[model samples]
Target: MAFDTKLKQWTSLGLGTVLMTGALAGCGEATKPADTPAAAEVSETEANSHAGGDHHGAEADAAAPATEAGEGEGGVTIEAAYTDPVVYKSAIAIAAAHVLAARDAYAEGKTEAAAEMFAHPVSEVLFDMEPVFASQGVEDFTGLFSDTSAAVFAGESQEQINARTDEILAALDKAAESAPETDMSDAMVSASVASDQIERASDMYVLSIDSDFYETYLDGYGFYKAAELTFSQNEAAIEAENANAASAIRSALALLAEAYPTALRPDSLDADASALAVAASEVQLELSQ
Candidate 1:
C-alpha cells in the first residue's frame, strides 16, 4: 500500500472515536467569509519568528479597533478592547513554537523533554489566553486547555496523545466560533487554522523519520534526507556569502521537488514541502540581487 494510505488507516484506527465526535459537533464549520479582507502584512522572516514555520502572506486584516482609551493612575493611556487580534495571534504563535520544540525533542529521543514542551503551551500560553476566549464568550475555554495539558503530561500512549491533541484543536475551533464577526475574528480563525496545520505537518514529518518506517520505505526516506542535507548546505553557503550559493540553492530545491512524485506523502506534508521550496527559491533570488 502507498504510505499515505497506510498513514490514513493508522490515524483512523487511532482517532476514530474522537474523529466521530468532532464530526458530530460540526467541527468543520467554515470560519472565514469568502470576501474577507487581506490580513495584516508581515515579512516571511517575521512570520517565521512568530510561528516557527514557513507560513507567509496575509489572508484577512486582523487589526481590532482600540476603543475607550483612558488615563491610568500613572497617567498612562490604556487602550482596551473586548476582542483583540493581537491576543489571538500571540496565542497561535506560542502554540506553534511549542509544537516545533516538542517535535525536535521527540526526534532527538528525549521523550520526557517532548512531553514537557507539549504541556507548556496549554499550561502557560493557552491558559494565559483564557481571558481572551472568555471575552469572546467561549465557555469552558480555560477548563479545556487545563484538561488537555493534564492529558499531555500524563504519560499516556501515543494514541491517547493524538486524541487529546484533537480535542485541543476542536476547542480552539469552538473558541473561534464564539468570536465576534469582524475582520479581526476572521484573521484569528485563519491564524488558528494555520497553526494547527503546521503542528500536524510537523507531526507527520517526525513520523516519516521513524526508524521502522524509514526502513520500510527507503526511497521516501532517502529523498527526504537528501533534501534536508542539500537545504542545510545551501544555508551554509548563503551565510558564507558565496557567489554560487543562489544557484546551489535553486538546484537543491529542484532536487527536493522531485520527491513529490517519487514519495508517498500526506497532503499536509506535500503542501508544507511545496511552501518551503517556494520560500527557499525566493531566498535564493534575494541573495542573487
Candidate 2:
C-alpha cells in the first residue's frame, strides 16, 4: 500500500483529533489582522502581485507573502496544521519556517512574539521526535530551540539572532536526514503539507470572525506563513508533474495571504475565507489525479 494511505490510516486516530494548534499560539513572550485586505498588514503592491504569475513566480510570491499581514484555524498552530502524518523532513522544515517568522518578528521589534514561535515547537513535537533522529544516528538538537528562544527574549541583536537562527536551521537539516523513506513522490509530500496547512488556515479564518479573535488571528497568520514556505520549496517538481495543480496552489496561497494580512487583527473582518478553501479544494482535485 502507498505510504500516504497507510499514514492516513495510522494518523486518522491522532492527527486530526488532537486539534491543538492552539498550544502553539500566544506562546512567544506571551504575545499576542483585517478588511479590504488592506486593513490587514499588506501593502498595495502585495495586494496587486497576487493577480497573476507563472508557476515559479507565483510560488515565490506565495512563500513571500508580506507581513503587512496573516492562517485559517484548529487552534491555528503551524506545528499542528502541517505535520500530522509527520513527514520527518517536512516537519523540520516547518520548524524552520516558524523560526524564520520569529526572526522577522524580532527584527521588526516584536520580540515577545518571536519568543513564542521559537520555543513552542521544541515543546510541541521537535523534542519528541528524538527517537526517529536517534534511530537515524542524529543527535538531539532540540535544546537549541529553547536556547535561541531565550536569546531573543534577552534582547539579542539581529546579527546575533540571525546566527542563532542559522545554527538551529542547520541542525534541523541534519535531523531531516533521518526522515523515513516513503513511497510518495516529493511533490506529493510537499503538496500534502500545503493542503493540510491551508485546510487548517481556512478553519482558523472562520474562527477569526468572533469579536474576541486576537490569538485566533495570530494562529491563522502562522499557519499561512508555514503553508506558503512548504509549498514553495518543492514547487518546481509539483509544477513539472502537474501544471494545473501548481497553479491552483498558488491561487489559494494568494487568497490566504490576503486573508491573513498581519499579526494585528483588524477592527473589522472582511475576508471571504471560503474562496481560499475553494482554491485549496481545486488543488486537491488536481492532486487526486
Candidate 3:
C-alpha cells in the first residue's frame, strides 16, 4: 500500500506538471523569456504568421510599454510569443524542484518535515473522508463491504491490528539505528521521502475498522458520501490519503521489517517510487468507488 501511495504521489506530481503547463498557456504564464532557447527555436516566419494584425489590434491599444517595445524585436520576442502552442516555463520547473526537494527530506529520515511537501489538494480530499470512515461501521456499508474493502481491512481485528502495528514501529526504530552509512543525495532523498508520504496513508484503514462496528452500521453509500466530501474539499490530500494508506502501510512495513527487515527492502526505493505513483491514481479511483 505504501508502495502504491508513493508511486501515486510521484506520478500525479509528475503529470501535474503537464496539466499545469497546459492550463498556464491560457493565463500566458507558461511562456518563457524571448532569450530562452526554448523560445528561440520558433521559426520567425511561423511566428510572424501567429502575430498577425488581427491578433495584435486589440492588444496594441492597451499594450504595456514592454509589450509594445517587444513587438518589433526579432526571432520570437516575448511579446510575440503569446500565440498557439504553449512552451514550458520556469514556473513548471520550479514546481518540479519543490517536489524533488520534499522527496529528498523524507529519504534522509526527516519524516515530519517531508510530510509538509504533500500536495495540499490531495490532503484536503482525504482529510474530509477519513473521519467519517472512522466513525461508520462496516455493517452500514453493505454495498462497499467487498473484496477490495476486505483487503483494506485485512488486519482490523483488535488482536491482530494493534499487535502487527506495534511490531512495525519497533522495526522502524531498528532500521533508523541500523541504516547503511551511505549518504543520500538530494534526488535520492526526495524520492524516498515521497515514498514515505504515500506509505503513511494506511493509518486510516487500520484505525477505522472494528469487528462490531460492521454489525450495526452498514451503509456503504453513507460512508462513501463522506469520502466524496473529502474529495470536494481537498482533492489532492484525499488522493494522497487514499493512495498511501500511510498508517496501514507503515504498520505493515514495520511488522514485516520486524520479522525480516529486508522483507520489502525499501532501501532500494526505485520500486517503491514507481508504486507511489500508481497508488495516487488508485486513490482517485477508489474515492469514486
Candidate 4:
C-alpha cells in the first residue's frame, strides 16, 4: 500500500479506538491527571493496532518508502528488501518496541493499555512476519505473542507480564537473526528501525493535524513512543557508528516529544506537520548516509 493509503487505514482503525476508549474512560475521564510517563498509553496503544506495524509492512512487496522502499526466503516479508538484512531485522524490532511499551504500561498500573499493546501485534505483525521467519530458518516465535498476550488478557501482574515480555522480546531477537546475509553494522540496522518508526510517527502526526478524534493523535503518539524507545536503546551503537545520525534522531525525537506530549488530543498542533515531516526526513537522511 502507498503511504497515503496506509495513513487512511490508520485513521479508520483509530476511530475504533475512539469508540473503545469512550467506553473505558466513562466518568473516570472526569479526573484530570498529569501525564504519568505514559498516561495515554492505553488509548494510544489501542488506536494503533494496525497503524504502527503496517507502515513497515506496506512493503509487502518492499520496505522502502511507499515509492521508495525486506527479504528473507520462504516468503519475502518485504519483496523489495528481501536481500537487505536490516529491513527484516528492523521490522522485528518495531514489534518489540510495541511490546516493550506495554510492559511499561503494565508497571504503571495501566493494565488495559498493556493488554492492548500485547494484543495488537498478534493481529498487526505476526502473520506478516511468518514468511520471513521461515526464510530465515528461525523457529516460529509466533506462540510467544499468544502466550504473552494471554497473560495480559488474564489480568496477570506486572511481574508476570514482564516475564512474558522477556519471552516475546527474546523470541523476536532470535527471529531477527534470520535476515539474509548483509554487511551492515547492527547499529545501522537499529538506526533503520528508528527511521521507520519516525516515518510512521510523521505519518500518524499528519492525520492528527486535521482530525477531531483524539485517537488520531494517539496513533501518532504510539509510533513516536516506539521511535523514542528504539533510538534510546540503540543510542550507544548508533552513536558509535555515526554521531551525526544519533544526533539527528535525538533532535527529531525531541521535536516529536514536544509535539506529542501525551496521548490525549491537544487543542491545536504543537509541532507543525511540515516540521515533523522535516525532522523525519532529516533523520532518514542521516541514517541513509
Candidate 5:
C-alpha cells in the first residue's frame, strides 16, 4: 500500500497547491507583479468584461432549445435525456468494468494504467449521467461524482473504491425514485454484479500472487514472451556497444518486471506459440526506444 499512500499524499499536495495558487491569483492586490501593475490592471478590466459576457452567453445558451443549442455541439444529446434509464444503466456497467480493471492494474503495480482505467468512467461515462440527474431533479451531482472519481484516480484504497461505488448506486437509486418512469432494476443488478466481480477478483489476484499462480498459470505465458523479447533486444544493444539503447531496453525490462513481477522473471522466459507471438509484437512497441 506504499504506492497508494504515496499517490494520495501527492494528490492532496497537488490539489492544495492548485487551490492556493488560484486563491492568490484571484486576490487582485496580492497577485499583481511589481513591474506589470498597469498592464495587469488593464488585463483585469478586460477579463471582467469577458467574464460578464461569458456569463450572459451561458444564460442565453441555457435558455435556448436543447436540440438547437446543446445537441450537436458536444453538449448532452436529446437522446441522453429521453434515454436516461438506458444511459444510466450503461454508465453503471462501464463504471463497474473500470473499477475491476483498475483494481487489477493496481494489483499488478501498473499505476499509470490503473489511473487511466479509474478516470475513464468519470470523465466519459459518468459525465453522460448529467441528463439523468437533471431529469430526476438531482441538482449538481457533478461535484460528488467528480470528487469520488478523483479519489479513485488518486489511488484510494479498494475499500474507498467500494464505498464510493455504493454511494453512486444510492444516488442513482434516489434519482430513479424521483423519476419514477425510469426503471433502475437492470442498472442496480449490473452494478451489483460488477461490484461482486471486483471483490472476487481482488481476493483471487492476491492469492495468486502469494501462490505464484501467475507464473504457473497458462494465461501468464505472454508475460514471459515479453520479457525474453526485451532481454534479446537488450543483448543486441550490449553486443553493438550501444549503451543508450541498452539502457532504454533495461528500463523497458524494469517496467515489465513491475508489470508481472512474480511469474515473468527475465531468466525463465518461455511461452506458448500464440502468446509468444502476441507478446513479441507488444514488447517490440514497448521497447521501441
Candidate 6:
C-alpha cells in the first residue's frame, strides 16, 4: 500500500475532527446564529485556537445543543453552523478517489499516471504544510492513518477504506463541537523531533531519488520511526510539560510560511509540494531536537 495515501486519509480526519469541535459552543448543539455580520466572518482556524482542550475527541456528543449567543467577559460564545456536509466530505473524498484511482492505474500498468496522481496537488500540499507538522514527527504523520478508533484508514481492504471514509463524513454531519484550549508541552517535543527527522529524510529523498529509491524508502521509514516515538512518548504526559514550545513553534511556523513561496518558485512544483515541504521541515526539527 502507498504510505502517503494512508497518511493523508488519517491526517484529514484528525484535522476535520479538531476543526468541527472548535466551531460550536457547548457539546453537540445546533449553533445559534451570529448576532452581527462581523461575527460571521471568523475563520475556523482562528476560532479553534481560542477554544480550550476538553473537546478534542474525534466525534462530539450528538444530542447537545449549542449555548445561546452571549458575550462572556473574556469573549463571545459563538456557535458554528455549516450549509452542507458535501463541501468538506467531497474535498476529503478527492484524496480517497486519488488513491483508488492510482491503484487502478497501477493495476493497469499506468504506473506513471498512478504515481502522478498520488504525487501531485495533494502531495504538494502536504509538503508545504510539513514545517508546521514536523513538530509532531512521524507519530503525527503516521497517526493520521492509525486512528482506528476514529478514522477508517486502518482498514485492510477497499470496502473498509470506503466505510471509514464514510464514517468520518457522518461524524462531520453532526454539529461541530468546540474543544477547550490545549497545552503545548507534548506538542513541542514531538514537533521538534519530528521536524528534524523529516527534514533529513526529505533532503535525502530528493538527493537519492535517481540513485537509490530503496535507500530513500528506508529514509522515509526512519523518519516515521522517530515521529512514532515522539508522538507516543509525549501523548498524555504533555499537560505536565513545558508550555513554551507552542510559542516557539508558532514562531517557527511563521518563519516557515514566509519561506514557502520562494522555495517552490524555482522548482515549479504542483500544489502538494508545499505540504510535502512543510511536513519534511516538521520532521527535520523533531529529529534534530
Of the candidates shown, which would achieve the greatest lDDT relative to the real structure?
4
Q: Put down candidate 3 lDDT per residue, 54-172, tens digits, no spaces.
A: 11112221221232333221111232122211101111111222223223333444322222222211111221122222232101111111111122223234343234323432432
Per-residue lDDT of candidate 2, residues 1-289 (tens digit): 4323422332333221122122223221123310111111222242233211100122223433332221111122233322333345545654665676677667767665566567555433443344445556667676677677767757789999999988987887676655555667767777876776666566566666642534445546666777787788779998988788888889888998889776566787788867876887887798888
Model 3 has how many clashing residue pairs?
52
Give the best candidate by TM-score: 4
**TM-score for each model:** 0.36, 0.65, 0.16, 0.66, 0.33, 0.23
| TM-score quality measure for candidate 2 | 0.65
Candidate 6 to truth, TM:
0.23
- Candidate 4, residues 29-94: lDDT per residue as tens digits? 122222222222223233232323332222221322322123222122455445777667656755
Write down the worst ten-residue block by lDDT for model 3.
84-93
Off by over 4 Å in 6: 1-190, 238-273, 282-289
Q: In candidate 6, how many clashes are counted?
A: 66
The clash number for model 2 is 22
Candidate models: Cα lDDT each = 0.35, 0.56, 0.25, 0.58, 0.35, 0.30
Full-model lDDT, candidate 4: 0.58
| Tens digits of per-residue lDDT for model 5, 225-288 | 2223323523643435444434444543444334344422234333233332333334334333
Q: Which should have the higher TM-score, number 1 or number 5?
A: 1
Residues 33-117, model 6: lDDT tens digits: 3221111122334223222111111132121124234211111222211222221222222233333333333444433333333
